[model samples]
Target: MQTINLLLAGFQSAFELAAFITVVVGLLVGVIAGALPGISFVNAMAMALPFTYAMGATQAMLFLGGIYVGGVFGGSISAIMINVPGTPASLPSTWDGYAMTRKGQVKRALTIAVTASATGGLVSALMLTFLSAPFASFAMRFSQPEFFAATVLGLVSVIAIAKDKPIITLISLLIGMAIGTVGVDPLYGQARFSFGIPEVESGIRFVVVMIGLFAIGEVVDLVASNRDLRPKKTDGKPERVRLRDILAVKGAILRGTGIGCMIGVIPGAGATPGAVIAYGVEKQINPRGAEFGTGVEAGLAAPEAAKNATTGAAMVPLLTLGIPGSAATAIMLAAMMLQGVNPGPLLFIMDPSMVYTIFAAMIIANVLMIGAGFGVAQMFSTLMRTPPAILAAFIVVLSLIGAYGVRNNIFDVYVCLVFGVLGWAMKRVGFPSAPLVLGVILGPLAERYFLTAVANSRQDYSVFFTRPISATILFIAFVFVLWSLWPTLKSRIGRQPA
Candidate 1:
């Protein structure tokens, strides 16, 4: 009953004209930024930070939350239409989404993507509204050991994505971890593998690497192949999505939303892992598992659902414990701190209105994203009508700019170009780059938590296994790895014919 009253009050605040307009504007900004390859929504939020200084605390949260919800789903626009992922989480979309585009079903693909994304995000926002207090209380009991175990689970989840080529996947993951180790040590702060370069000592930013690995290589492929970018008209009419289409993938959306909400609450496990894991899981369970990369509807729906679902779930740790679960949330944290507001349990108690209003904004944002997503996707699809050379050139230029904008450093731009060439080479060999990107994102987190846990336990290695939560999660990870490999193992045994 108290929750109901608080939510009602939240609706009142969020519905105010100024607050509502801010949400709409932020959502538009997020959609555009996310739809553009290399310019992630996190960058948009960072750019929007200075603008928030002029607003009230509640308004600031509302604005940022709107962006958080919309931006997560916005990346699918490019992924579905252009074969380029605007964000790391959108990588899964390239598997089946672009395949759909190639078959001239771009409208159908975007419809499924946006619908699933909105549904998943809406449910997650509700979860955030109602479950945050209890979840925050539970999270408070987590120590470094628990965090390390959770990070390990996220790392091992990549196995699910590589059932057929586990060996190659592991190799790629290890190489990325090696790259992650190139700069200052997370624990001791001692620089390693810097080779005396001032910029190298500071470490490589994943955003720069992500832009290069995804955007530049894709542009090169477009230019080299001279692929047409225009969406084929369906009998001279726009393709209309039906209710039955959404109903067809309801199960995938539910499963993806569940996985995303669970993973998003775990600090350091962000939307990218959530989306990838959802795709892997969906591939395993769907009837058309073998057809996943061949433009299956469920394949397109699951990752889109999972990626957007993380938006609200990722805020649980941020608002309740003052821990940012993802890069975007980290910017929101900065925004809050800039406003002299410290987020935590105490903030909830003292500023229930602000907290609840932000929750309301997230709910509204997800609901509004369906329309915003369609508008931005339509605009981008129109841009696809331009000549291939012009479009590819723009992608490359924007990618370079995005890389340089990461820290306003020229070295990142150079690093991006190098990785671009490397990414193209890897693609030519059919090597998976997703696992490598995952390793780079999660490896450092695992290292930091493991080192901290060991130090806290007086260098005791058994600390992870001894803790109940950590042990349980690790056991789950073990089960996931076995499950992922079971199909391959069965196939090999069947071929042997004992």
Candidate 2:
């Protein structure tokens, strides 16, 4: 009953002119930003941060939440249309979605992507609405050790994403962790790898690294390959999707949503891993598994659902424990802090209206995304008529500006360009960059929690395993690593001469 009342109040608050307008504007910005290569929704959120200062706390949450919901779905637009993912989570879309586009079934591919995305996001938003309070209560019992264990779980989950290529993934992850260690020590406050550069002491921002790694490399590929951006026509008629088409993939959407929600609740896991893991799972179980990369409908539907599903689920830890689940949520954490609001159990008790309003806004955003997504897709499809060189040039300039905007520092831009070159090189070699980005985003948080946990236990290493919750989480992570590696080990053993 109380939950019902709160929801009613939330709707009342969210429907007000200012709040409604903010959500609509933010949703549009997010969709446009996410549909454009190199301007990820995270970048859009970061750029929108300063503007949030002019709004009230609840309005600001509504605005950012709207963007969060819309942006996750928007990336699939470019992924399906251009063979280039607008965001890291959209990587799986290119595998099958672009294949569909090549066959001139672009409209059908997009319809599957959008419908699955909206379904996943809607379910996730509802979960956020009802589950966060109880989750917050559970989180109240967490200590330093528990937090560290959760972070470790998130870190190891990346292995599931790598499957048989763990070696390269580990290398990429280690490189990111090393980069994360460059700044001042979390405990001692003494610089480790600054080398006397003042800006280095403050640490490299993940936002700059993300923009450079994802944006610049993609644009360079566009310019180098002179890729065609125009969609292919199929007998001068557009493919139409019907309700029956969506019903055919209901199971895939459900599975993807489940995976996404589970992954997203982890303190450091985010949409990239969620989407990748879902694709892997779908490939394992679907009857068309062998034809996964050949534009299977399940292939396009599952990851699209998973990526958008993570949007609302990622908000769980952020709202409950004040822990950011991904780089995007980290930006939201910064936004809240800037507004003199701290999320956690206290926020729920003290500002139920704000919490529920944000929930309502998430629901509203996902509901509205169907229209917003198609509108942006239509606009971008038309814009694809532009020359590839001109689009690439614009992407490059916008990416650089996003990098520089991190702290309004030119040094960050230099770092971004350097990483951009490295990212391009990595891509040419077929190396996975997603794991590296994940490590950069999560490594510092893991370090902070690990150090704090050890200190709290008076340097006792057993503290992580002595606690039941912490031990269980670590055990699960250990089992996950073994489970992921067993297939390769079994295959290798079977290949040995008998």
In candidate 1, stretches whose alpha carbon ends up further than 4 angstroms from where it belongs are 231-238
Best by TM-score: 1
Clashes of each: 0, 0
Give, for candidate 2, the lowest lDDT window spanning 10 residues.
133-142
lDDT of each: 0.86, 0.82
For the record, the alpha-carbon RMSD of candidate 1 to the native fold, in angstroms, is 1.9
Q: Candidates' TM-scores?
A: 0.95, 0.83
Query: On residues 317-360, what C-alpha lDDT tens digit does candidate 1 reach at each position?
Result: 99999999888999999999999999998998999999999989
Q: Please, what are the lDDT tens digits per residue for candidate 2 over residues 1-498? A: 898899889999999998999999999989988887656788789889999999888888888888888888888887888765777688778878988987888888988898899898989889888888665556556687877776676577566556457799889988887888888999989998999999999898776777677667767666667766566789855667888988998899999989888767666657876787688677666877667767889989998998888888889889888988777889899889998999987888999999999888898998899899999999877776788777667667877876776678999999988888888889889887867876886688789989998998899999999999899989977887786677678999999999
